[model samples]
Target: MARIRTIKPEYPVSEDLASVSLPAERTFVCLLTQADDEGRQRDNAAVLNGALWSLRPEHTALDTEDELRQLAETGLICRYTGCDGRQYLHVTKWHEHQKISHPTASRLPACPVHEPAGWCGKCKAKGKGCARPAPENFRSLPEALATPAEAISAQRPCTAATDLTPAVDVSAAEAAAPGKAAG
Candidate 1:
């Protein structure tokens, strides 16, 4: 079943995301909610249409298939046949945007083209590396979806979230207390 997914506010302005047609953009956004915790799903257009565009009778499975091709071509998503010979797709930057607290393991096989050899959805082998490391080609965080700290630092020097003090008059607050002096 599909799981909840995050859509950072920066999505609409992303150069790579904006490169696609509006329909394809909508498809991409909708696909976010439809994806598994690992950002994977079956690559059947008909199934996707039934799940994603069911309310909109105007859209068809063929349209979804075309959008999928557009997403793949733009490197937003990866499509491949698993070892079981079933087709699957995964968002290329799943980890960059999502911060699932307790992600469930994916039942689908990993894409061989993107994953290390003998990868079994787990980073088990010594020195094999992360099972789903972010792609090297990803743009810097400022231009892409960034974590809260990255976003803050991109605009200014990094500071802990707690360092931000609330705007209030301390003397007035102290005066309001029954036993405190205004000074």
Candidate 2:
């Protein structure tokens, strides 16, 4: 099964990322997507590069070492030698983005960075991550929101005017009310 992964806003392109070409970008994304829920993977250059290139033969920009170096230089990945005398990688901003409900033991040695405490709504509700039970008011969400995938799939692409009217119609009585309609 595919482990869940996190993707930040600037994940595709950033200051440290812009320097690398498309090949490096693809390889990095592949590793991140295939990594464990904790954003860790074996730091074997040959295996990574071979898998990446084999998957996308057209992407022949950067070699594995060069791509790994780029990722490390950008503070996106941290590679280290484990007690087993093998290298491992850890994405720096993993926890900040991903909320793993079931985290597995990392085979690599610990390289934890101390972070200041912050509010975790789930933690206060006796949960590890955001997998807490919903309140009683749950399932009251509107149909569109409750089944977002179906709603999204049912939508047709609108390439017309940007100032389209609201989908929710306002009754004439409400529209005529004092200060209801803006100037």
Instruction: Say which candidate scores most in TM-score.
Output: 1
Alpha carbon deviation, residue 114, candidate 2 (Å): 7.7
Evaluate residue 76 in candidate 2 and report its C-alpha lDDT on the 0 to 100 scale.
Answer: 72
lDDT of 2 by residue, 23-83 (tens): 6677777786667666777777677766667676644434776777777767777765433
**lDDT by residue for model 1 over 90-174, one digit each (tens)?**
8888888999999887766565556545345433442243334324432212455788878788999846655676686467656
Decoy 2 TM-score against native: 0.52
Determine which window of 10 residues in candidate 1 has minimal summed lDDT.
132-141
Model 1 quality (TM-score): 0.63
> Can you tell me which runs of candidate 1 are displaced by over 4 Å?
121-183
lDDT of each: 0.74, 0.59
Q: In candidate 1, residue 177 scores what lDDT? A: 87
Q: Cα deviation in Å at residue 73, candidate 1?
A: 0.4
C-alpha root-mean-square deviation, candidate 1? 20.1
